[model samples]
Target: MTDALSPAARLALDEAFERDAARGGFAHRGAVAVIGDDALAAAARERFGSPIRLFHELTPIPVAPPEGCERHGLVPELVDGVTLVVGELPRTLAGVDEIAGLVARHADADVLVVLAAREKNLERGMNERPRDSFLEVAASRGRDKARALIASGPRPTPSPAYPRSEIVSGLDFPIAAHGAVFAGTRLDIGTRALLEVLPAQLDAAALPERPTVVDLGCGTGVLAVWTARHLPGARVIATDRSWSAVSSASRTAQLAGVADRVDTVHADAGEGIPDRSVDVVLLNPPFHDGRAVIDDMAHPLFRAAGRMLRPGGTLLTVYNSHLKHRGALERSVGPTSQVARTPKFTVTRSIAR
Candidate 1:
């Protein structure tokens, strides 16, 4: 299967591992953990010929695993006794820290982690994050516009600091966030804009006494928990593709005392939610795919919302004004109208056909 990985990046990472192994760095018989996708995982299996464990966070469509490999869905135990980890480096510093902490806290004592990304995305802070969890951290020479970070000698770090909780101003509930969760514990401007106009839109929309609400691409369950608290009779479903996001959302709902009313689902754009089953969908779709800005990133979510909304059901979305998503919403969901706008954002309401 074709992967999103850059070939040069993957090759540089592989070369790093080979060089380390030649120097007797990888001597343990412990398991191999591949943290992102099949690209590096496949390479590890080829080199080690061992049963590898795979973990994915942001990848929506994971390729089939190699022989003797199994997918582990963020279970820390799967990382236990792992001597080597290979994968793409995450985009955020928190993500880098989390990976470092995970390996230090669970993997074998001599675990070696090789994380690679395109040279343009590398930062000095990425190197420092692993130092908090590993004794030795270094960067390989850049090759073919790609570089790899090598970390070894796990340190005794305190308990995991992820799924961080914080209370924000103007919000009643606390936001819990894992390392890779978007916007961290603070509300983004787009979501804030959407929330500003959401109440009036809900009041104007004709709906049942107990509406089924969905928060598509829910980051920290802010919208879902808010909906549940605002509408006592409503049942809210919050879904996101990232495991960290789903975990954060679940923790947010629990901390907000709305766990009974809010359900957290780890999915891609509300996938597995029945068609025409939801009364309303609150969406603040992401415009970035990794580090690249892609305006059509929300198209799948728009179509997903269209399928999940019942006839005449409403979709409330807030996005950067420059994206001009009104045309996409109208074509994907149904008739659309703007509800509110800020200097940077625009909130729109769409009615399903």
Candidate 2:
């Protein structure tokens, strides 16, 4: 069956399966296993010839196991002896840290991490971070710059360092963040600048009762939390595509004591949000997709905001100064007006037409 895959994919599958088999593969395995990456999950299915359980989100949620298997979530507490496989390393340091923290949580499990050679530093970090939770860690010889890190011998459970919460002196409430969440429980310069200027522009008192607000890429829900608390009558929706981001934002809302006012949803650019329903949309749009720095990533988000916002509603955004998203904002959302600009970032307010 694997022969049908592209040559590169076949090679990847062959190498990974061969190494896994040499380590005494899943055959007769007593442990429950979880695969992180989708492509790797496919390869694992071919190798194991069984339906492997997939934890699609960064933070594991409850999933009914395949028939005859126990239910599993981020941690399969009921299952003794677990196997964790990370097929690909994430692109960002935060993402890498998140994966490391997740692997650490299952300290009692056997862990195997397969990373591409294209990222030398990531492979090195993958090998090192496991040592923090596992008592013994070993590395396999490299093949095609792809290698595996094998770890076992669980240590006494260490306090979880991911999903960390911290208080920033100026902010009204604390931020709870997962490792993969942007800014790591701290406000980034751009977000800070935007927040500084937002109150004056939003003028919550002037807004209609129960004003609907959307935080389009609500990383850790800082903007949403602040809005929900300050506006009092506002109904805030915080949305981000990353599972880790959604989980972190949800936690941030709770810690801010505005969970009733702020709702967190996992989505790609406000997909399910109804058109012309929101009174305001706050954005700290990303300039990159994966490793590629591109200005186009914000375009769709702008369009989505334009669609979701009511006539005369506002879209407040902060972005890297150099990207010059003003023109894009004007074109996608409505007329754009600059709110504030730091040397590194620009805050703008766009009104829906």
Candidate 3:
């Protein structure tokens, strides 16, 4: 279903399914686990001949849970004595960390199999991260730049390393992150660049009174925490689709001593926020949709910002320079102006019309 899945992934999926089917269906194997939304679970169901337990980064969120499957939020321990099928979807370091954390948490799982595109850095991650939790990890030869990793024999000691915290150089407070949050605890270069310019831009005396700021896609709440610290009078809302991110953001805000000023929400975009109710929106839009590197992912975010901002409100964004989001910003929000630029990133201010 996801066109972004590489040919190698398709082959790996077929192999995994056939392996299970030959061994007599996943239902017979005990419990079955699959991460992410329905598309991936659907693919697994087609071959496994059974319902799958769905694990989501966020809980009680808008996305519907798979039918007849137990739903869990951010808890890998909920799945055990099962075969976990991981689709090659997450493309970032944080995503890899999250999956590895899941494996570590569910060390008792009968088998952990990954279908990943070999050309990506997935092989390295697959080989390394599982070693923390499993006694044996092996990989299949590459096929069409796709590979399969099978890990078993859960290690008894060494607890899961996740929800880690690190202090970044540019910020005053430490950032806490879960595996699913983008960039994990590390401050991404694009976000770091945006943070450098945010203080001056947000501090401008001409800003509206008691502004409501929304951090769209607030991975780990770096922007929200920083905004709350600098703009003391402003109300900050940090939102992300990942429940892990939402939880991590909340912790970051609290750790930064701004919990009273910031609100963390599990949401896709700024979903329930009132129309024209926000004054400023900070964004570091994701570049990929599943595994495909596409600029179209930011279009909806831009439109959401446009819908939430009042006339003359501002949307500050940082993105990969090569993405060239200027045209889309102009069309979706309003006229756009460059705020800052580095070798790899571009920061812009788009005003809502």
Candidate 4:
């Protein structure tokens, strides 16, 4: 097992091939296999030599195994003579059972297993027509289930960019986003309208030396980074339920030369932020995760802001015109007022007593 290969993963490949070569009759039959991750696959290719054929995602097994398969596509034939296949999905989830069955049919049945992500939350947050709470999808199957765990520590992120994301924003602030795909360039319009609606004077007189502000459901950290630039004296804290968002926010802050004034946290906004420390809060609340419509995301954030703010602190956010922010703010922060409103977004201010 090339388990302990150093910097060059090729060492693992050499080990796997040598081990396969050493085995006898059973080995000659071409002990077919599947890999745990891309790292393992690359290593194997190094030792075995390449021009290898790669299967895309999870293709169903061929009924006839393709007569003279090598003529159609060169399937690797080894001493054991079994065919090996790898999946594009780093992890597998439900309904992939058929693919798993197909892999077993082609390779070693007992060896037919899929690799999963180390953590579940690292799952990509997907939005269909994106309407409250984001429904996240892991890079591959089993990752959604968090099966690749070791004894301790945090679950790992897929390396080598298994979970690829389009970096939408400037290097000034990082926005390595995954889970959802955007067709147009730059951040979403809903976000633009929301960020643009943020009132510059909301906390001007209220804040002390560079008042701290948080973009609670910060999707791209666009609002957070922009707030930093717009409010030079402001210390910005960006928090998102999505880890991808946190990473993006951190990078955005770094690029903006405000990393010292910016902090990104991965905790759920529902659980609340560090107690009683914020002076201003900004948000662009989402209405749903995919097709399911929900309105609970802004609740905890509203409450959190009320608890964390300094007495007369302000929770500023922009919401879709269809949503009413009055009831939520009234219950959490005593009273709320509309700062700005348009067909798509309404900028509101909640005052903490």
Tens-digit lDDT track for model 2 on 1-353? 54443333344455556666887876765433443444545555657665465555542344344443332333335223445453444545555555555665653356554433233434335566656656776665655545555555555663365678999867978998876666887888878988888889888325798899999989999999999988898999999877778888888888888999998887788978999999999999888755578977899999999999998899999999899988888888899988888899988889998
Tell me the lDDT of model 1 at 306. Answer: 96
- Among the numbered candidates, top TM-score falls to 1
Encode model 1's per-residue lDDT on 1-353: one tens digit a residue.
22445754475457656866776855457568887766666666666666788887855334466677777755576578887777778888888888888888889886778888777787668878898888999887787788788888988863375778999987999999988888999987778888887788898887799999999999998999999999999989999988888889999999999999999887888988999999999999999976799989999999999999999999999899999999999999999998888889988899999
- Kindly report which residue pairs in candidate 2 clash with one another: none
Instruction: Please give, for residues 91-181, the per-residue lDDT of candidate 4 as tens digits.
Output: 2221132233233333342222222233432234211111111122122223223432111111122112212234454334444443222
TM-score of each: 0.92, 0.85, 0.81, 0.53
lDDT of each: 0.83, 0.70, 0.76, 0.49
| Model 2 spans with C-alpha error above 4 angstroms | 1-16, 30-37, 57-81, 107-117, 120-126, 138-148, 158-161
Better of 1 and 3 by lDDT: 1
User: What is candidate 3's TM-score against the reference?
Assistant: 0.81
Clashes of 2: 0
Error of 1 at 76 (Å): 1.9
Worst 10-residue lDDT window, candidate 2:
71-80
Clashes of 3: 2
Error of 4 at 112 (Å): 8.1
Rank all candidate structures by their TM-score, best first, as comma-separated numbers: 1, 2, 3, 4
Comparison by TM-score, 1 against 2, better one: 1
